[model samples]
Target chain A: MSTTEMTVHAFTRMLERHGADASRWPERQAAERLVVRDAKARQLLEEARGLEDLLRASLPVPNPTAARMRADVRGRLSTGPSQQLIDWFDRGPLWRPLMAALLPLGLGFVLGLGFPEPAADDDLIAAVSLLAFDQGTYLDESLNASVEGGEYAP
Target chain B: MARVQARDSEALEHLMVRHGGALHSYLYRMNPNPSDVDELGQEAFLRVWQHAGRWRPERARFSTWLFRIGHNLCIDRHRKYRWIAPIKTDETVETAEPTSLRRAPDQAFEEEQRRQAVRRAVAELPERQRSALLLCQFHGMSNQQVADILEISLAAVESLLARARRALKEQLVQFINTDQATQ
Candidate 1:
C-alpha cells in the first residue's frame, strides 16, 4: 500500500508485521497526514523500525555452557549422601516417628544380642539386693515391753 | 511426599535437565549479569527443593511454580545487588561460531555492533520501559504474558513498550545509520 494511503492502524499493523515499534511514529508527519493523521508519528515509527531492524539483524545469541552447567549442578548434588533414603521417608509420612524411635531400640537390641553377658550381670545384682534385704531382722519394741509386763502371750 | 522434594537426587537431576536451559535463558534475559543469572537460577532450584513439600497439585502447575520461583529470585537479586546493567550483546561469542557462516561476516559484524549500541540505549531508559522491551523483544513473550510477569495492567505494558520504542529510536538512529553505512 502507498504510504500516503495507509491508515494509522494499518501502518501500525505493518510495523508489527515488520517487528517495528508503532508508538514511535514521527509525530509531525503523522499528524499532518490526517488519513494516517500522524506524520511526526510516522517519522518516529520509521526510526523505531530502523532500530528494530538493527536489533533483530544483529542481536547476539548466547551459547550457554550447558555441559559445564550440568557438571556443576551434578557435582554439587552428588557430593552429598544419596537422597534415596530421605525420599523413602518422605513418601511414608507416618513412618517418620517409628523410624526415629527404632534407632535407640535397635541399638539396645543389637547390644543385648551382640554381647549377652552385661544384662546377665544386671539380673544377678538385682537378685542379690533382694536377698540381702529379706534376710535382715528388725526388733519390735512394743512386743518386748508387753512380754516384760507379762501382758502378752507367746 | 512431594515428588520433587521427596529428596530424589535422580529426580532433581531430571528436573534440571528438563528445565534448566529455558529457565536460565529467562533469567539471563531479565538480568544482564551472567554471574547473577547463574547464581539466581541455582538458588531458584534450591528453593524448589526446600519447599517442594508444600506443593499442592491443585494449586498450580510445576512449570508455573518454577517460573514464579525464578521470577522471585530475580526480584530479590534486583533488590539486593541492583543488577542494573542492560542486556549485553556478546558479538565475539555470537560471530565466532562456524555454524553461523550463513551470514556475511562484515554485515553480521556491523549489525551486531548496532545491536550492542541499541541495547545500551535501552538500558539507559526507565526501568519500566527497559522491562517492556526485554519481555517483548528479547524473550518474545506475548504482551499478556509480559504484563503478567511485570504484574501490571496490559494497557500499562503497552504504554511502557510505547515509550521504550520511542526512546530507542531517538537514541539509536545515529548508530543504526552508521552501522548500515558500514555494511
Candidate 2:
C-alpha cells in the first residue's frame, strides 16, 4: 500500500514488525510523512530507533567466530571418511555407541536361536560329508534311492 | 551453486565467504552457548556442501535455503540441550565497547552494561521470538524469509516480532531510563 493511505496504526504495526528503519520499510515516504505529521508516530519511530541502536550495540558480533567458523568449516569439509568416523566418536559417550552397536547384535543372536530344531543324525552325517568333500555318502544315498525305485543298474 | 552442487570445495568456500557472517550470527543468536557457534556454523556449511545438489535456486534464494538449514540445526540442538542457561559472561561478550573501554572507561562501562542488559533481554526471549527478531533485524531477511527459516506463517512471524519487542521494551525500561538520565 502507498504511504499516503497508511494510517498511524498501520505505521506503528509496521514499525513493530520491521523495526523503525525507514529505509527497510516498504512505505518509507509514507512512514516518514506519518512521522512528520503525527507526534505519536514520531515518538514510536524514535523508540524503535533507540531499540534498534541498542540491539546493534548489544547483539552478538559474528565476525570473531565468522572467520574461525569458516576455517573450521573448511577443515571439516576437507576431512575424509576415516576422519569422520573419529569425529563421530568424539561427539559423546563411548558406552552409548557401544551399547547401540551391541544391543542389535545381542537381539539378533537371541532371535536366531529362539526356535532351534534338533538336527537328525542323517542331516549331521550329510553336513559332515559335505564339509569333508566325500562323494561316498552321496553315491550311497543315490544308489539306495535308485534300488528302492527298482531302477538300479548293476 | 552448480560447482558446489558438483562438490566443489572452492565454490563452497565462495558461498561461505558470501553468507557465512550472517549465518554465523544467526546461529550465535539461536544457540545460547557460544562454544557451539563454531560447530553449528560448520555443520550448516557442511550441509550446504553435502546437499547443494538438492538446492533449487529457482525456488528460493540460497541465503533462505541456507538459513533454513541453520534454523533446523538450531531447533534440533535446542531440543538436545534444553536446559542450557543463557550465559552472558564478559569474556564471551564480543561487542566493540571492550576495545573502547580502554579509552573512555566510564562511558564504555556504561555501554557495556547496556549491551549486556540487551543481550540478557534478547537471550531470555522465547526461542521463536528471538529467531524472528534476529533473522529480520540483523540478517535483513524479509518476513517471508524469516517465516521460511522458522517454518512459520508470515502472520506468525509478525506476531513473534511484536511479542519479542514488547518483552524487550519491558525488560529494557531500566536501560532506556538510564540513557535518558545520562543524557
Candidate 3:
C-alpha cells in the first residue's frame, strides 16, 4: 500500500510483519514513515512499541549462577560418553556397521570358548565305528544275495 | 566441534563456556521450569557432544544447530510431560532483576505482577509461535535465523512472529494502554 493510503490496521500489520525496527522493514519503511505521521497510525505504532518494550522488559536475563549450570553441563559432558555409548551403538553410523560385522564373529568366538571341544574320546569313537561296521556288513550281505539271485535268473 | 568429535574435553569446555548461558536462557524462556530448564540444557549440550560429528557448517550455523538441539529437547520434554506446569508462574523473572538497586516492596510486587502477565501471555502462545517469538524478539535473532532454527520458511517465521506479537499485544492491551497513558 502507498504511504498516504495506508490505514491504521495496515500500519499495525506492517509493524507486526516487519517488526518495530525500520531498518529491517526496507520495503515498508517509506510507507511506515508516512503512516507514522497520521494520528491513528501513530497510535497503533505507539501501542505496538509499548508491547515491544514490555516484551523486552519481560525477558529474564541470564542467571549469573548459570555458571553453575555451565559447570553442571561440563560435568555431564565429561561423563556423557559412557551413558551415550549405547546411543552411539544404536545410532552411530560407523558403530552400526562395525557391530553388524563383529556381532556374529563375537558370538561364535564366545560359544567356541565357552564350550571347549571334548578331547578325542576313544570309547565314543569305538562305539560309533562298531555301529557303522554292523550296518556295512548287513548292506554287503543283502547286495551279494541280490547279485547271486540275479545271476541265476539271467 | 571437530575437536569435540575428536573427544577433546578442552574444546567441549570452550564451547560450553561460549554457548551454555544462551542455551540455558533459551530453555528457561521456553519452559521457565528450573528443573526442566537445567535438564534440557544438560541434555542439549550432551547431544551436541554426542552428535558433534554430524555438524556441517555449510548446512547451518553452529548456534543455529545448537539452538535446534535445545529446541528439540524442549519439544520432547514438553511432549513427554504434558502435565508439567506451564511457563506462566516462573519466578525466575523476579530474580532476573538487578540486585544492586532494591525496589520498595510494593513496587517490586507490581513489577512482578506485570512480568507475570507478560510471561503468561507468552507461555500461552502456541508452540511454534512461542518459539518464534522467543528466538526472534527476545533473543534478537533475525527472522531468517529463527526460520533456520525452527526449520520453517522465512515467510513462516515472519508469520509466526507476526501472529505472536499480535497475540501478545491483544493479551496485554490493557497494560500497554496504561503504560502509554502514564508515559
Query: Largest TM-score belongs to which candidate?
Result: 2
lDDT per residue (tens digit) for residues B1-183 in model 1: 255676876676677777777677667766767777776777667667768887776865565567667776676666555557677765334544476465688866765666677667755888666656765776666666666666778778777776777676677768766755655
List, residue by residue over A18-98, the lDDT tens digit for candidate 3: 677666664575556666578877776677789888888776654635567668767755555666676446433454657
Ranking by DockQ: 2, 3, 1
DockQ of 1: 0.12
Give lDDT tens digits, candidate 1, residues A5-123: 54666555434422354343333344335435567555646555567666655444466655656666666555445564563343223446468669899899888887656878999
Kindly give the number of clashing pairs for every candidate.
25, 0, 0
User: Interface Cα RMSD per model, in Å?
Assistant: 7.2, 3.6, 4.2
List DockQ, one per candidate, in order. 0.12, 0.25, 0.23
TM-score ranking from best candidate downward: 2, 3, 1
> What's the lDDT for candidate 2?
0.78
Tens digit of per-residue lDDT, candidate 2, span B73-145: 7776676556645745547555554554464778767777787788888888998998899888888888888
* Candidate 1 lDDT score at position B76: 60
* Better by lDDT, candidate 3 or 1: 3
Per-candidate TM-scores read: 0.54, 0.76, 0.71
lDDT of each: 0.63, 0.78, 0.77
Q: Which CAPRI quality tier does the interface of model 2 achieve?
A: acceptable
Question: What TM-score does the A-chain of candidate 3 achieve?
Answer: 0.43
